[model samples]
Target: MTLTFAAPTPDAIPLHVIDQSNCDAWLAGQGEQVSQWANRNGFTGAAGQTVLIPGSEGSVVMALAGFGTADTRARKRFVLAAAAAALPKGTYKITSGLTGRALEIECFGWLMTGHTFDRYRTQSPSTALLVAPAGIDAKRVEVQANAEALIRDLINTPAQDMGPDALQQATEALATEFGATCKTVLGDDLLSENFPMIHAVGRAAEKAPRLIELNWGTSGPKLTLVGKGVCFDTGGLDLKPAAGMLLMKKDMGGSANVLGLARMIMALNLPLQLRVLIPAVENSVAGNAFRPGDILTSRKGLSVEVNNTDAEGRLVLADALTLADEGNPDLIISMATLTGAARVAVGPDLAPFYTDEETHAAALFKAATEVADPVWRLPFHTPYEAMIEPAYADLDNAPSGGFAGSITAALFLRRFVTQTPYMHFDIYGWQPVAASARPKGGVGQGPRALLEALPDMLDL
Candidate 1:
């Protein structure tokens, strides 16, 4: 999957957009030669209609795509993606007057439509080439697209193959690619290393649990990413209903997204030391599985009482965040499919991020708006910290009363991240329904906005 953006040649075919009301006016303004060819071919630009005008040199002169009434028209950003997918492999420019965010987002759609996760498949499309708009960076688009694709692919894979060990392998592979240092503490080693909570949550699974670490770059600001890699969350001893367990394979979507963001950082060669910590585990139910009423100690030495084994994502993330905080990174960002409260607040398309740092939140908001990735800011609410307090332990993994579950979860993670500027994103990484650019499957949330905002956040 390599894409190239080069300057378009004079003979490059134009992608013309035609609205229903302005079709005649647009065709009237065309060159006499092009107009005659269009007329002879009966090219009337009706909404969702397409026509190719042939040139005298046996090449396509232009492609006309129709739009419906302006008021009634579908507001799909990637309406032209299907068209792009059908185009021959060549550098192309949208001559449809798209600019600013519209142009950037549409180009992103074009690039994404060209993505095919054929890692174990027999057939895949050749990368589609498109000439980037003037002042737009092709490398940036490629980085974002690659990151999103990686996140989607990882989340879409089943638990059978994408368990903790496989996650370590993926981390090691990325480390090798970027010349980063990689290490892991597996199974009982997690207990020896003081990641008892992580080990306890995953000890019952056949595929052993591990904490994966990757370090890259040097001599700059430090940025750490912590992800909850609950490889297959079956709700442990508490147990989820059959419906709730259906999408448990994607419970590690946060880990996938963090790895995706890490890929972008390494690919762009950002001027910052990067560390990724993933507490990869499978929350399975067995005789040995950690249960409710159990008290576990985390890497930070904080005691956590498990009230509901279903709330396991935060347990793994707590350990990873504690390890990341040990390095005292300038900023720490953690992503997890940690709560249903987030989805109830902002739905699946919008991820909600919690940060005490206003400047970082502003940067993320701006980047999300610019990229159309869409994230809303949720409050840390220091007062809510009391909600997670336990009578017998330092904290309760599951807060009582269930009010502000997402905020309380953020507060729990905040306790583990002391020195660094910390932010937590509670994301629903699966799109329940299909839309313009987002298909109805594993979706990458927050990584795009995070990747776009990082260079500026780190002052690179």
Candidate 2:
């Protein structure tokens, strides 16, 4: 469910945010009884700790939350959830401290805690509401938080309920909301449309393999975004282990994240010709499944040898990226849960991205640092170009030896995208553990970072 904001009522409780250094001084000003209460409870103001003060009639009068000091790393985003989870059910207002982006993060955190995917079961909606803090843009916080909720919901859904057809429905719904146009090339039509690689990877699935395209905006620079939308990957003939297949439902997280980004852009009315290409498919096993060692031609007309059927994300992405590249837009971004090597390199929290453009690199890092959505840059490494090239075809879907697997995967995709400033993000998409505002489920990797960087990159 979407979390919304409203004006504070008289019954709203005041949430006082404090740090270890300021705890003693602030308690002293509250008089002896309040100071004694804090001392008795041993509330030294550690981060993520909350204390609810009670009134004479057995109702909560005030609440105190610890923001901690600069050394606490995870204390950055969604810190206010501690108070939200601890307090009694009621409306709340921040009485002091926290302004600008910090305040926005706190408010957003409260909403995030309320977002739970109860598709199979029902969850009690959170009555603990947060009134938007002073000097903060309430509408923007609501939009971004709702967008994040949408991403998580899409990612958390089971593959049975979220195949290529379902992804197309989601895309079309988003288009309907923004008055954009959406078209789909499905089933055997993928071959007629010259997207052979996409069809090859998804021909065995129950749902038809398709490409979902969305277009919005009439003026300004052309911006194309491509997302790898492999709805469910059983690894085709190559196959993954039982454990690996467990989380395959989240394989389409790239599409979910980009759609979330698109929602934010359109809601805010960013001036640009926005185009989104999602090659939605499911790699299932059947009599007709594409086999290993098969050579498939891409929309770019470059033949790729499928060394591993499990490496299907790139096969589908190659065709979609080629289509986006044809427009020669100012910038093209491809986000995907493409490789495990990326997780081994930087883990899940820090998303690994590749781009040779110096200006784009600088802007990406700056935006990530500013918003606390971390991303690390991996080199395009021309030396690794030879790794993706096998003797038989123009590219090898899976390189041998697997020594820079992520880099080689990026290189393979880089072949499809020529010039026009391309950026590829090898994202994990799934949050292994819960941290601050981010729950332990499907999460948006680079959307916030890109959102912060795009306006400046486009000179808007």
**Candidate 1: tens digits of C-alpha lDDT, residues 1-460:** 6434546777556777666677777888987877777678666654446567777887877777654455633344465565565556665666874677757776777777766656667544534456777656778877788788888788888898899998899889989988999999998998888888889999999999999999999878999999889999889988899999999989999999999999988999988999999999999988999989999988898999999999999988888898888888899999999999888888887899999888888999999988878899999999888899989999998987868999999999999988889989999999787654556678888887987788778887
Give the candidate number with the greatest TM-score. 2
Poorest stretch of ten by lDDT in candidate 1: 68-77
TM-score between model 2 and native:
0.97
> lDDT tens digits, residues 79-134, model 2?
76766776667788899857777777778788877888789889764567887777
Q: How accurate is candidate 1 locally (lDDT)?
A: 0.83
TM-score of 1: 0.90
Rate residue 428 of model 1 by lDDT.
90
After superposition, the stretches of candidate 1 with alpha carbons farther than 4 Å from their true spots are: 3-11, 17-24, 31-49, 56-58, 66-75, 86-91, 119-129
Can you list the residue pairs that collide in candidate 2? none
The lDDT for every candidate, in the order shown, is 0.83, 0.88
Can you tell me which runs of candidate 2 are displaced by over 4 Å?
Answer: 55-59, 74-76
